[model samples]
Target: MNRKKKIKQILKQKAKKANDKLNPKRKPRYVSKAERARQEQQVEDQ
Candidate 1:
């Protein structure tokens, strides 16, 4: 019985990891000063 419980717990953890990989959360990206300036210039040109 103890072994079965441990196996089930391991399976649950693996499933959770798989689910997380399938549906990832959004994270903010860093923007360098040069890139930001280029973007601003493009907007001004348009």
Candidate 2:
């Protein structure tokens, strides 16, 4: 019973850590439409 409680505590701690890691909002790098078009044109030309 004590071992089960300990395992539950460890599992809960791990779940909390994983949730913290997964929930944070990440900012993406901004790309301009002109730059994207230029890249696509270069690829097509090649």
Candidate 3:
């Protein structure tokens, strides 16, 4: 019973770590008007 409890605790810790990594606070990618113009210029230069 003690071993089973320890295993459960380990599994719970692993799950929490996985969840934290899976959902991270990050900024979404967005292209501004100047950035769009630069990209277009790059394409034209190519």
Candidate 4:
């Protein structure tokens, strides 16, 4: 039971990895809140 579930999960992960390698998704870069505040401050100062 437990062994079967674990095997299934591993196979699922392998399939997902292969699919992603073939068709990768584009992810936007993340901007932290502190960085955002700094940018706003710079704009206001200028």
Candidate 5:
């Protein structure tokens, strides 16, 4: 039982580390059409 628990703990730690490395910390940026238009307007004004 102890050996099984130790193996499970090790596997869980490895999986968590792999997942953290694979996944980004921040969400992706999604620009809406209105935001894009506003940015374009600002560029034109400059």
Candidate 6:
């Protein structure tokens, strides 16, 4: 809420974005609940 805290948070966000850009990480893809259930059903059938 304070000015200093806001500035620090903004700076932290900027730094994080820069770091991620420089050394990007591979994040896993997200599967929805229905898709997950379908996959499980397929596996069970196999």
Estimate TM-scores for all models: 0.54, 0.49, 0.51, 0.54, 0.53, 0.51
**Most lDDT-accurate candidate:** 5
lDDT of 4 by residue, 1-46 (tens): 9999999999999999999899967986899999999999999999
**3 or 6, which is superior by TM-score?**
6
Off by over 4 Å in 6: 27-46
Give the TM-score (vs. native) of candidate 1. 0.54
Q: Please write out the lDDT profile of model 1 over residues 1-46, one tens digit for every residue.
A: 9999999999999999999999968986889999999999999999
Supply the TM-score for candidate 5. 0.53
Clashes of each: 0, 0, 0, 0, 0, 0
Model 2, 1-46: lDDT tens digits are 9999999999999999999899975887787999999999999999
Off by over 4 Å in 5: 27-46
Answer with 1 or 6, whichever has the higher TM-score. Answer: 1
How much does each candidate deviate from the true structure in C-alpha RMSD?
A: 4.6, 7.6, 7.1, 3.2, 5.5, 4.4
Shift in Å, residue 43, candidate 6: 22
State the weakest 10-residue window (summed lDDT) of model 4: 20-29
Total clashes in model 2, counting residue pairs 3 or more apart in sequence or in different chains: 0
Give the lDDT of residue 29 in candidate 5: 92
Tens-digit per-residue lDDT, 6-29, candidate 3: 999999999999998999868878
Please list the C-alpha lDDT of all candidates, in the order they appear: 0.96, 0.94, 0.96, 0.96, 0.97, 0.95
Off by over 4 Å in 3: 26-46
Flag clash pairs in model 1: none
Task: Name model 1 segments beyond 4 Å from true.
Answer: 27-46
Query: Residue 16 CA error for candidate 3 (Å)?
Result: 0.5
- Score candidate 6 by TM-score against the native: 0.51
